[model samples]
Target chain A: MRTIAFAVALALAAGLPAAAFAQDEGPSTAEVDAVIEAAFPGLDEEWAARLAPDETMEQCNASANVPSDAVFEEIRARAAGTIVYPDDGVLVGSWENGEKLAQSGYGMRFSDYPPRRENGGNCYACHQLTPQEVSYGTLGPSLMGYGKLRDYSEEAVKAAYEKVYNPHMAFPCSMMPRFGTNGVLTIDQIKDIVALLMDPASPVNR
Target chain B: MQKLMTRKISTVALAGALAAGLALAAAAPPAGAQTDEETQRGLERFRQMLREDPWANPALLDADRGELLWTTAAGPKNATLEDCDLGLGPGVVDGAFAQLPRYFEDAGRVMDVETRILWCMQELQGVDVAAYVKRPHPSGGQPVKDVGAIATWVANRSEGEPFAPVLDDAAGRATVAMGEALFNRRSGPFDFSCATCHSASGQRIRLQELPHLSQPEEAQVAIAEWPAYRVSSTHVMTMQHRMYDCYWQMRMPQLEMGSEASVALIAYLVDKAAGGEIAAPGIKR
Candidate 1:
C-alpha cells in the first residue's frame, strides 16, 4: 500500500502542471474553510464569524497580500468607508492618555474577554514610539520624533488619525490592525493614539 | 496581550530601577534609552549563556517525566507505549522524531509527533483520546501536560539529528500542500495568516524577532527549537500547544488539540525545516 501510494504521488508530481505544486493546487478554499471551522467546534456565532475571512482579507490571501491594482483600490476605498471620525472633528486628544494607551498591549485576546480595562493600541509592539522605550519591535518604521520631524503640522495629525483608524485606507495589506474600523479601539481612543504620534508634547515628539 | 502587558510593566520597572542605580553609581545616558542594537545584543548574550549550559534548561525535567510515562503501564489495557510505532517500526525510538509528520498507513493520514502519540495511546493503551484532548494546557509557572512532556522526550531523543520528513507519498504531499496554503491564508479579526508576522525576515513584535518561515534557513532554525522551554510561561510547550496559543493570540477560537489543521501546519513547518538539526527542548524567551 505504501509503495502504491508513493508511485501514485510520483506520477502525480510528474504529470501535473507546475501550478499544481504551487498553492493553487492545495486544499480548495471551501475545504480549507471547512477545516478551520471544524478545528473550532464550539465557538459562538460572533467568534466563528472571525474565522471566515472578510472580502478584503480573501483578496489579500488570494494575492499573498499583494492584490491586483484594481482590487487594491477597492480595498482602500472600502477601508476608507469604514473610518468614523469623532463628532468633535478633533483628531488629537491628551498626549498623556495617548502615552498610556501606547504602553498598554491589552484587549482583543481570549484572556481579555470581559475586559477589565480599555483596549490598547500596542504601538510599541511594532514601532519605536518613544526614545525612552528601548525594547520596541522593528516590524513597523520608527515613529520617534514623529510630530517634531513633521513640524507638528495639522496635515500630519489628520493623516495619523486616518492611518490608525484604518491602516488599509492608507496602505492596503498593512500588517497593523484596523483599530477604529475593526472596533478594537474607540474613535476617542484613536484620537489619543493620534496624539501619541502627532502631539508635540508627546514623548514620541521629544 | 496579558503576557505583553506583564512584560511592559516589568520592563518599565526594570528601567526605573536601573536609572536610579546608575545615578547613584555614575552618569548614564538615560533610563530605557538603549538602542535597538544594544537590546538585541543583550538578549543574544542571555540566550547564548542559556545555550552554553544545556543542563540548565528546565524542559529536561519534563522530558524525564515523559521517559517515566513511556515505560509505565496505566491505561485500560495497562500497557506501556514500548510497542508504539512512531513512523519507525514498533518499539523503535532512536532518531524517530526527526522524520515525523509522515504518512501513517494504518491511520491513513499524516500526523505530527503529538497526534501520533495520541493515536498510540488510544490504540495500544486503550486511552480515552477525548478526555486527553480536552485537558487544559498548564497556566504560567505550571508544568506541561503529559503529552507535551512525552513529545519533549521523544523529540529530545532526535536532538542533533537533521529533520528528514519524507513527504513523497500522496497523503504526505496533500497534507503539506494544505499546510503551505494555510500558512499564507489570511483570516480572523486582524487579517493575519502565519505569514503576516513570519513571512518577512528581520521583523519583530516587541523585541521578539519574527522568523520568515518561508525561508529554509530561518524555518529550520526556528522549527528545530521546539518543544522549547518558554521562559515567560515557565513550561515546556509542544508544537501543538504553540499552534493553539498562536491562534488564540490571533483572536481566533481555540484550535482543537491534535486537529488536522494543527498537524498540517506542523507538517508544513517540518518540510520547510528539512535538513535542520533537531534542538528539542531549546530555551525561548
Candidate 2:
C-alpha cells in the first residue's frame, strides 16, 4: 500500500495529467469513508454526529494536518472559542488526585460506560510526569521540572491549567486532548491536573 | 450562488488530490516482503499452546472472559460498546490495534486506542472513571482481574492485522519525532528513557528480550501485542497501563495517562512498526 501510494503521489506530483495515473486506482476518500462509515452499523444521532468531520477535523483533513500560517491562525481562533474557563477562576486543585490522574490511563474506554461517569486526565500517557514513574511516554516534552524551570509563576501555573483544559488554546493543533473544553474533565479536575504539573511539592516539580 | 461557487472552487484544488495521495501512501504496507512474512505463525503457535498447556498460558481464561465483557453493557448508560472510535472510525477495531499512537488534535496529543476509548467513555457515555483512573491496574502477582477482561475483549477484535499509524501529516510526524527524542532523552537517578532497555538493537531484561522499538520487526512485535492479559498479575492491562507499570519499575514518578508525552511515545512506536501486523489481546507474563 505504501509503495502504491507513493507511486501514485509521485505520478500526481509529476503532473501525469491525472489521466495516466487515473487508470491506476488508489484508495479513494469515498472508499475509505465507506469503510469507516460501515464500521458503525447502528449509531444514535449523538454518536453519529461524531463520525463526520468537525471544523478542526475538516481543516486538518484539507491541509493534511500541515496547515499554513493563515490556516493555523484560523484553527487556533476556532479552537480557542471552544475553550470555557472555570467561572470561579480557580485553576488549581489538589495535587494528590492530579498525581493519580496523571499516572492513570484508565477511564473513558468502552468498558467505562453507562455515561455520567467521572473522567480521568490520563496525562502520563504521553508524558513523563515525576521522577518516580518510570513507565511514562516520551511523545511530549518531559515536564519533570515544569514548575522548577518556570519558577512556578502564577501565570505559568494558570496557563498550564488552561493548556490541559484545552491544549488548542496554546498549540492550535496539539495532539493533547481538550480536557476541559470537550468536557472530558471538569474545572476542579483541570485544577488538579495543573497542580500535578506545576506544584512544587508535586513529584513533577521535584 | 457565490458561496456555493467558492466552495466548488476550493474543493477542486489540486491540494486535496495531493493530500489524498499522501494519506494513501501513509496507509500502505511496509517496504520489505511483509506480505510473504509469517509473523502470525508464532502468535498462532502461542495461541495453540494456550489451549494445550494451561500452565504455560493462564491468560486464555481471562481473555475468554474479556470477550464476554466486550459484548456486555454494565455502565450507567446501560449500552454495550457496539460503537467506539479507534482512530479508523467507530466500532472499527479491525487493523486499528496497530495504527494507534497517532495524533488526535482533540486531545492535543497522540493517543493509543485505550486512552482514546477512555475519552469516549467519559464524553459519549458519561462514565465517571475518576476512581479507576486513580487506582492502578490490579497487578499484585495475581491475574489482573478487573479491566483485563474488557481489554481482552476489545483487543481480540483486531488480531493478525497490520501495524500502521496515520502519521502522514505534519502533526503525526512531529508527534513521532517528539516521541523518538523523548525515548532517547535520559534523566532521573538512572538517567533512562525507554531506550535504556528497548533502544539497543539486542537488549534484554532478565529472561525477556527487549526489542529495539526504534526499528521495524522488533517494534512491530512489541507494539502489536498489547492490552494483553498478564498471567502472573492475573489482570488485563492496556498499553497505557503497561507503560505506567514500566515507569514504576524504573522507579520514576508515574506518567499521566493520555498526556502529550504518552501519546507521542505511542505515535513513535506505531510509526516504528508502520508496516507490522496488529496482534492484540495476547497473553503476557
Candidate 3:
C-alpha cells in the first residue's frame, strides 16, 4: 500500500518496505574504514587520513546531525577545545586585504593545489557584506553595516573571529564549515576577515 | 570605500550583461524584440515547463534505448544479459534497482547498479574487465557507454517501489557505514565534504537549488531522482557519474567507476533514501 507517489519513479524503493528507517543502528568505524579503502582505489596517504572521522564527526554521523542535548553539548565542547588563538593579541588586520579575501572564492579546491596565491576566505559565498554586490548569497545573516550595528566594540570583533574560526564553538551542528579549524585559511587571514566585518570604513559598514 | 565598491560592482555587472547580450545576438535570432536577458529568462522557463510534461523531455528516448540494450546480446561472448543476476535472480530486473549495493557472494563484495552491470559484462559476456575500467566517460553528443543505458533501463523497472534496502546484514551495513563516512569526509584543497553543500537547506551554488541530503525527506527526493538525464550535459548521467562529476567540481581526483569508494557512497545514499519511492531516468537541468 504505497502512498505519496515518487517523482518520476523507475520502479520502487529498496526490496522491503517496513518503512521504518534504520535510525538505531548504523555502520561501525571499522566497517566504514574497510569500505573506504576499497571504494577509493589507490588513495593517497593524505586523502586516506581525511576519511577517518574525529569524535564530533563520528557522533554527528551516528545521530544524523541531530544529536541529543547531552551529545550536542559534548560535540560543541570538544570542538571548542580544538580552536587555537592567534599568537598576536591584535584581532584586526588591514581591511583592504580583508576585502580581497571576502571577494575571493578560491583556495582548498583540488584545482588550487601546489599553492597559487594566498588562500581566500570565500566569505561572500554565504554572506552579504557590501551593498554594492547584488549577487551575494543569503545562507548567512547580512553583514551590511555589521560594525555600525555593534558600534565597533572590541568584544564584538573577537566574537566575529570565533564565529569564523569554528561556528560549532557557539552553535553546535552548524551548517558552516570550520574554516580556521580545517586550515582553509591562516590566523592572519582570519584576522583580516574580522577587520572586513568590523572596520568603520569597510564597505561592510557602509 | 563603500561608494568605490558599489561603482566597481555595477560596472562589472553592466559590462557582463553587454557581453552576454552580444553573444546571444550572434548565437540566436530573437523571436520578437526581446532583450537577451528576457530571451534567456524565457528559455529557462521553457526548461521548467518541459519538466512538467514528460513528453517534452528528450531523456525518454535514452531510457527507451536502455531497455533495448538490456535484452540485446552484447560483448565478446555475444551473450544476452538474461543470465546475469542482479541479486534478485538471474536476469530478474523487476525492483532490482531499489535493492542494490548489496553483497553478492559471486562478486565477493557489495555492488551497485553500475558495478553489477560490469560484473555481468565480465562473467556472462566474457569481456575483459580492463577495457571498461580503462575507458573514460563520454560527454555531450558522444555515444554513452552501455552501462549507462542498462542502468537507466534497470532503474526504470522499479519506478514505483519504495526504497528499503537490507542494511541488517554484515557486509551491507559496513558498506553503508563507509558511505556515510565518505559523505562527511572533507578533503581536496577546498576543505569541502558533500555536507558543506548539502547538509543545510535553502542553499545553492549559483542558481541551482541544493537539496540537503542529510535530512530523510530531502534524501528521499534527491537520491531517487538521480541517474537522470541532464539538459545541461545533453546526456543521460547515472548516479555514479553524478558522484564523479561532484568530485571533479570539488577539484578532487576522479573517482574510479565501479570502485569500492563509489559503491560505498551509493550504499550510503540508498540507506539514507530508505523507504523513499524509486524515481529514475529523471529529467534534470
Candidate 4:
C-alpha cells in the first residue's frame, strides 16, 4: 500500500493529468459522502439537502464537469424543463430593478439565512454588464452592447431570459449559476435581469 | 537607484488614488469606467505596498499573543507547549510549519499545524479538545482563538523557509489522494467544487482573483501566503478558518474544525505547494 501510494504521488508529480488518476485509488464516493455528512452534523433538512449532489451535480462531479455527450444532453434537457416563464409572457421587465439585482450579491449564503431582502443575480460578479461598472469581474464575457449588437429583436430577448434562467440549458457545465431553476432568482427577477441585458434603454446598450 | 525610488513613490501615490477610486466605486453605482487591467494593477500595487511594510500588518500582534500562549502554563496539567513535537521531536518549532501536514506516527494520522497543536493541547496540557473544536471562529474585529494565535506564531517562525512537506508515507499519500478527490468533487446547491472557482487560471469573483490550485506555480504562491491578515475582515485568519469559510461560501454545511476531511484538503494543498516559501501571517485583502 505504501509503495502504491508513493507511486501514485510520483505519477501526480510527474505532470500526469489529474483526470488520469485511477478512481479506485482515491477515497470512494461513499467515503467522501460520509466525510461530508459527518463534517456538517445536525444541519436541518433544507441545508442538508443542499450538501448532497443532485443528479446533474453528481454527473458533473463524476466527470469533473466534462460530461459525456449523452450526459450533456440529459443535463441540458433537465435544465430546460425547470425553467418557468412569467404568467404575463413578458420576457422583459424593469431594467432599473434588474441593475440592482445584478449589483447586489445578497442571497443563498449562510449569512443570508432568514433572508432580509430578495435574492440577486450577482451578475457583476462574473460579467461586465455596463461600461460604467469598472469593478466587474472577468469570469464571464463582457455583455456590453448585448441587445444593441443583437438588434434587440424578440428572439434575442427570449434567449437572454433563458440564459439567465438556466445557462446549462444552452451550455452544459457553464460556470454561471442556475438562477431560475435553482430558485435563487424568481421568474420575474430573471425577467428583470434579461431586461438589463436586452433592454434598449439600459446602460448595457449605451 | 534615485529613479527607482522616484518610481516607487509615484506608484504609491497611484495606489492611494486607485484605493479612493475603489471606495467610491463601492459606494455609488456604475458611473465612469476604469478598465479591468488598470483596476487589477492598482490593487496589486496596493497589496505589494502593504506586504513591503511589515509594520502595517496587524497579524503580528496576534503572533505575539500566540507566543505568550505557547510558553505560559495554563491548562489542567499546567503544562507549556514547549515540549510538544511538531514532527521534529519535542520542543522544535523553527522551520516546522513548512514541513507539516505530514504523517505522525504517534497520532497514526496525518496532521496539519492546527490539528497537531490541538493534539498537544489535549495530551500535554490536558485541555479539552472538543471545546476548542466546537468554538466558532471569531468574527470581524474579534481576535482569533488560542489555537489560531499559536498557529500564527508557529507559522511565522518558518518565514522565508520553503514548503517541503514529505508525503511519502502511506497515510500521507492516501490523505493527499483523498484531498485531490475532494477538491474536484462538485457538490452543494450551487454545483460547485473547489475546482469550480479555483481550477481555472485568471478567474475572479467580483474583482478578486481566484488561484488555479491544480497548477503548481499558482498553487505555490496561493498556499505560501496563508494564515493571512484579511483587510476586509480586520482579523488574522488561519488555514482552518479559511477552509471553513470557503465551504460556507460554497453553500455547503459547516466544515467542522480539525476534521479529517479538512486535514486531507490541506495536505493536498501543501503537497501541491511544494517548494513555495512560507510567508505566514501574511497580509491580504
Candidate 3 lDDT, tens digit per residue, B1-285? 474355345545644654675587578765556543465476577566656654444445555666677778878789888888988899899998888868999988988988998889889988787677665466776645778877877887788788867665878876776677678865444445787788788875533568888788888988887677676676778888888878865546667889888888888888888999987767676
Q: Which candidate number maximizes DockQ?
A: 1
Interface RMSD of 2: 16.1
Candidate 4 residue B53 Cα shift, in angstroms, is 3.3
DockQ-based CAPRI category assigned to the predicted complex of candidate 3:
incorrect
The RMSD (Cα, Å) of candidate 1 is 8.5
Candidate 3 local lDDT, A134-188, one digit each (tens):
5556666778899889999988988888888887778776666677887878889
lDDT of 1 by residue, B1-285 (tens): 474355345545644654675476367566456676685776576567667756556677788788788889979999999888998899788899998989898998898989988999999999999998886477787899988888898999999999999786878888888888888877776777787778889998887888999899999999999999886676888899988888877877788988889999999999999999999989887
| Candidates 1 and 3 compared by lDDT, better number | 1
B1-285 per-residue lDDT for model 2 (tens digits): 474344344434433543675587578776443321243344345446543432333344455565455556757787655576667777676566556666666666566666776666665566776655655366465555445455555665666767667887766765665566455543322223466567556443422456788888788778776766554454556777776666554334455565566666677777888777665655665
* Per-residue C-alpha lDDT of model 4 across residues A91-197, encoded as one tens digit per residue: 99989999999999887888888899998878898788988787787878999999999999999998889888888889888877788877888888988989899
**Candidate 4 structure quality by residue, lDDT tens digits, B231-271:** 67868899999999898777777788888889989999999
TM-score of chain A of each: 0.87, 0.81, 0.79, 0.87
Please state the CAPRI-style docking class of candidate 1: acceptable
Q: Where is model 3 chain B poorest over a 10-residue stretch in terms of lDDT?
A: B3-12
Which candidate order results from sorting by TM-score in descending order?
Answer: 1, 4, 3, 2
- True lDDT of residue A100, candidate 2: 79
Native-interface RMSD of candidate 3: 4.2
